[model samples]
Target chain A: MATVTILGKELAVDADGNLANLSDWNEDIAREMAAQDGIPNLTSQHWAILNYMRKVFEKEGSAPSIRRLTKESGVDTKTLYQLFPKGPAKRAAKIAGLPKPVGCI
Target chain B: MPSETEFQPIQKVSIVISKGSLDGVYPGLIMANGARMEGIEASLFFTFFGLDAILKKRMDNLKVATVGNPGMHMPTLLGALPGMSAFATKMMKKEIEKIDIPPVGEFLTMIHDSGAELYACRATVDMYHLKREDFTPELDGIISVGQFYEKAAGGQIIFT
Candidate 1:
């Protein structure tokens, strides 16, 4: 486990850096987390992916894999990588307050 | 002695896909895709029968190797029966689809779109009398084994 401080609050994170409590996630927290990870500007496109991830996690109890995101999230694989940088699936899940997706794609 | 805290993750990988069977080709693709998901640079080299994976005409029609595959739990004689390979391939395809794994063509496109470089072997291409137009447009190039090694230099090489 690890801890991150954002918005004057200390939040616990998993070993993979996702928020410990799903309820702790908010636009501010996500922005701060993204900034900490070197993405200082969060565009609407970024928000679109983040929201889509959260919606799927809410319904499916896990984050969508890269393939699913590409097929269903209105974002192509290349753009997803551009939005989230390296490891789009993992990084986007982290920002979206979800656990690391399982299995290799 | 110095402290041994210099552990590092793999920076890059070059995977060789050498078989054409559906089962044989997937391991390399899965690994290459996983490598890119980890921020590691990845490249794939297709040779011999593996060239079928990139060949536009045959990419989607790869079959499970029923013959001589002990893992199928069937006797070799039964495995050789007509249409056995096709049946096994259909079953495998269903299972793969159930798990959301795409068909070979789509999967290869996904991997390529995700930034992994793909290549076909020059020797195999010539041996099979294949042309550039025969391969998927996503292919980066067809190169010799020496060129493959040159591109794969300074990275882990995996033959699957």
Candidate 2:
């Protein structure tokens, strides 16, 4: 376990840096996490991905995979790489305040 | 010269599998999927009996290996009964599907779309008389073990 401070409040994070508690998530926290992940600014594209992941996680209890991101999340693979730089699935999920995706490398 | 801190990170993982049953194939798929999930390049090499899982016609029909298995709770005699393999496969499939995970076919599509490279063993293809058309459309290509080795060179290789 690890901890990341967001807006002066510390929250638990997983070994891979994903939020351990979904309750600790919010848009501002998302922005802070995204910045920590190397994206100092969050664009609409990043929000779109974050929103989609959080929405799916709310119902499914897990974030969607990169495959689902490209297929159903209205984002394409090339653009996803451009947005997240590297390891889009892990990075995006982390920024969205979700746990590392199940079975992720 | 590359900076000490800028040396290349591990970029790829090669998984070699020689078992073809449902149980055998899913671990390889999960590992490859897991690798891609972490932004690593993942390649699955199917050889020998493992070729059964990637065969277009048989990929979706893979059955569990229940015979002489110690891990499964059932007695070895019960493992030989008709429908046991299918029953076990169905049970496993249903369990994984509840979490929104796709079936074997769709799982392949997801991993492929996520950038995991799929490959078939050339010798296995030839030995089985399987045509290139017999594998899923996502297969990068069939290659010999030597070629696979060349591609997998330094990162990591796991035999499943």
Candidate 3:
């Protein structure tokens, strides 16, 4: 496992992979997650979503389908929308701390 | 210039276009469009009344909300009067169109063409009793909340 200090907090990086070199956006996300009491404090609901998203990416090398996310998390569609006001892909990618998906703006 | 390999790849992005006001719609569209230009895979999930922008009939008639939003900075209360939101929406739309950016309809099409997904909340659809036919053909599909999360799992999420 690798560890990095962001916004005065040390975050443990999973052995799956490491994020590319820190960028402004990366730092910003790290700060935002840190403000939420480090990623460890994230609710199981969020963790479940993020972890599954990562797994999907690792397996498919592509974005996962929304229908699949709903089935996997057992969270309602409306609740997921409420959780990610922008949309699921954007929010999940950010929280999962993966690079932006291909074909976005 | 940063070569493709030199630049970092975007893993995910989620954008929420929640405002029913016309002016509010542009920001979400702009951001979503911008993200697409950057080569990031993105999705625009319309919920609540925001679904108006995607509805074939109502999309062209969307209006801005000028009253009671603390987030909006208006030069004058009159600027946001009843009809002003609509006018403002038009002006904003014109400006964006002038830049060669596609109109809302076309922009949504581009997003879909680029492989970006669009979803309408099933609950909202049910609450409003909106029929699938009411939406434009571009809609990827209707989805439940849990399904939305499954897609949103691994990337950046934004609430516009």
Candidate 4:
């Protein structure tokens, strides 16, 4: 496990840097996490997908995979890549303070 | 002592599907899909019998390998029986569905929609006299072996 500091509060993240406990998630934490990932600013599109992911995770107990995210998040694959960079599901889930999604590679 | 970490980044991956059977197509699909999900460019080349994989009607109707398959766990004699392969395919499909994994057709759509390029072998296309109409609209086009190499250049090329 690794740790990320958000709002001066330290929280443990999984090996992939996704938050291990969803309760530690909030907009402030998400902003910090996004900054850590090289994005100093979060666009409305990023927040849309992140909030959708967080909502689904809070209800389902797991972050959505890229497949589910692309299908239902109203974000196309190319746009998701543009916003999330290296990997959408992993990065978005991390910023949303959700655990790593198990379904993706 | 060498460090335990190496940061090798994959810019692209070309996955070749040589077999059309259900077992054969999935590996290439999974790898390419994985690469695309990782934000790496992915390309798929289907050759020989594997061209059946992209055929609009047969792509989703592939059969599990039963005949002479060591992993199938059945006697060779039983493996020769009709419907055995279909039965195994059914069982595999059910399990895959239970895991929320998309079926073959839907998976292909997902990967294609995700920006992964799909190609078919020109030799196979010529031999079969196959037209573009024979395949799914997602088919990028039929390319020669040399063209495949060109496309695979500067990327990890995997033969499956």
Each model's DockQ score: 0.77, 0.37, 0.05, 0.53
Tens digits of lDDT, candidate 2, B10-60 = 688999878988888888888887777667888888899888777778888
Per-model TM-score versus the true fold: 0.96, 0.78, 0.54, 0.88
* Residue A88 CA displacement from its true place in model 3, Å: 24
Error of 4 at A20 (Å): 3.9
> Ranking by TM-score, best first?
1, 4, 2, 3
lDDT comparing candidate 2 with the true structure: 0.81
Identify the runs in model 2 with alpha carbons over 4 angstroms from their true place. A1-45, A56-72, A76-85, A98-105, B1-10
- The count of backbone overlaps in candidate 1 is 0
Task: List CA RMSD, all candidates.
Answer: 2.1, 5.0, 15.4, 2.5
Off by over 4 Å in 4: A6-11, A35-45, A76-79, B1-4
- Worst lDDT window (10 residues) for model 3 chain A? A16-25
Please provide, for model 4 over B72-136, each residue's C-alpha lDDT reduced to its tens digit, 9 standing for 90 to 100: 98998898899999899999989877766678888888788778999999999999999999998
What is candidate 1's CAPRI-style docking category based on DockQ? medium
Better of 3 and 4 by TM-score: 4
lDDT of 4 by residue, A1-105 (tens): 678677889898887767888787889888988998898999998998998898888788877777667678788777888798776777788788887777843
Please state the interface RMSD for every predicted structure, separated by commas: 1.0, 3.1, 10.1, 2.2
> lDDT tens digits, residues B1-160, model 1?
7554566778899999999999999889989999988878999999999999999999999999888888899999999999999999999999988877889999999999889999999999999899999999999999999999999999999999
True-contact fraction per candidate equals: 0.67, 0.41, 0.08, 0.46
